[model samples]
Target: MTTSRGGDGQSSVEVGTFIKTPSAHIVEILAVAGLDFAVLDAEHAPFDFGTLDAMLIAGKAAGLPLFVRVPDFQPSTLLRSLDLGAAGVLVPHVDTPEDARNVVARCRYKAGVRGYSGGSRSSGYGEKGMLAAVADAESVQIMCQIESIEAVDNTRAIAATQGVDGIFVGRADLALSMGLADSQHPDVLKATERAIAAGVSQGKRIGVVASSLEERKRYSDLGATWFLHGSDQSLLKQAARALVRA
Candidate 1:
């Protein structure tokens, strides 16, 4: 994870970017651009195991903590992502404390029903041994996305859910659920604030996707400790547009 510096020379928040292209080259570019970490947007992008493996290998070589945002809260997907050596996993549409709990359970062997196997790549393919592998797997971060009004109302309970490391606000979906097209609407902001406060009160780190550096700072000020900005596809479009104008 990478922390951004404020005027005071201290970084209160960590920042990264989202990857949607499923390319190892894109992941390498993120590393060279000095990003601290990255999340493969598997929820929207199609990535087979070979592709994920390639990106994960690239991320490792670049010394970046690569994570995967699974399409759902399925235990098999979570387990497979971890087995692919993701630093963590982000599960989407977590609407209740129970959902959050289940996500965490899938990430850990002792607490939940994650099928254990030390022969996976995450365990050094048996090099690290089974006992040590279990411990390492347990340390992987689990981030639950709170994307609905129901989740916002149950924010405190979700944050307090054991083994949950953080809560990521999916503003776009939250906005859609509120019958709005703008995520910056007053109601959406209010719900975001409430979720942030609940996470802070429970001593859990809060996360959000920032469209710009300014927005990132704004969310940081609002107690969002983790921020993801931009994406491979968006960056490509912006660059291509600039080139056309040039």
Candidate 2:
């Protein structure tokens, strides 16, 4: 139900791209280009803790919100990302309400078991004081990814879970899990719609990775507010290909 607003104070579709290059300069460039956000693809990319630490710092310096897509549902991974000052986390393969609940439990403090460290960057290195720090940390966005058929069926419940800030539909994995080769296959589209609709019904923000402007519009029409258009690698490859053609 929450929307990202532009400088003009108008609600606009949130646009971002996947950060797979593992470069702090790339993160700065994306922010300078005016992207609404960026997700460091730690799940698929070779980003170690030190690398992530530098990139997160770059994102902060560039005035960009950087969310990390963690490799798994490990509490340690989530804890580390948050500790390093990631804006939020995109937890993948959250197939059930229990999984969603577990994510919330791991990321929160008062209501869950997130380890506390006043010296961490997230707490402003003990400058913000414990109460203010806990408040800010708990405010970090927590999005659950719906990637499989089972996840689609439970999308509503997952969105309905408290502390779940949004639902991100992972169509690529959904297609593969459904035995399809195309992410845009009709069945995949249908499942995407179903998941989005379920999240909307629960009054949750919806997000998706759209390969093209048309694809982004299609999902936008289906109630997806946040869109990740492509990855740094894909965009670079495209620019290089276009340059060679030119």
Candidate 3:
């Protein structure tokens, strides 16, 4: 298979369904369970910098690339996640070109103007040159969430942004964007399928946030190569209902 390098031109690795959760130990456990990458949910989950750092350390120790899903579009949040040693940062609700551009900036050092600290998991905790490590890792993976009509309309431009390595689609918010309280119509699936088509055509890795594995497969045929498999907090509940139902 051909290796697809990120903006940094480093090893282009394939990641499986990365579930969100607050525990670093669980992150490590999942890595051992055979996941290429794992993301710490800093966006929707209750977690602090200290906890995030520990997760990063655990993920790295387990030889898994760690990503952070930040809560918002704040550049500071994006930079902090990278500086703390996250392999990439996922920003949610990216609707405009400016939003895409600004989020991408957080992946750089000098030009990115990120606040740098060498003694972090990214630099091996002071064992490496902090600035260089960050610059390299900054370009690792910048996943921008596209979950609205606004984002869907600007989908092409967002994927074409300089620092973006992949596109993540949040269907629930997207459904709302289309003026539906929740998507039960084929129209939502059509919109998502279109987004995936755009992503594949642009050579960008397309990802989806599925409520379940079966739901994700619906889009897998549409060229979705990545998935957010399960969340740490909800995996059992999901499995119980989906796989172990009575």
In terms of lDDT, the best-performing candidate is: 2
- Candidate 2 lDDT, tens digit per residue, 20-52? 998999998999899989999999999999999
* Model 1 stretches astray by more than 4 angstroms: 1-11
In model 2, state the lDDT of residue 91.
96
Clashes of each: 0, 0, 1
Each candidate structure's TM-score, on Cα atoms with residue i matched to residue i, is 0.93, 0.96, 0.85
User: Would you list the C-alpha lDDT of every candidate in the order shown?
Assistant: 0.87, 0.92, 0.75
Native-structure RMSD, model 2 = 2.0
Overlapping backbone residue pairs in candidate 3 total: 1
lDDT tens per residue, model 3, 11-104: 3444555545667678767888787676788777778888887888787788877778888867678767877777777789999888988887
Best-to-worst ranking by lDDT: 2, 1, 3
Clashing pairs in 1: none
Candidate 2 vs candidate 3: the TM-score winner is 2
Measured by TM-score, how close is model 1 to the native structure? 0.93
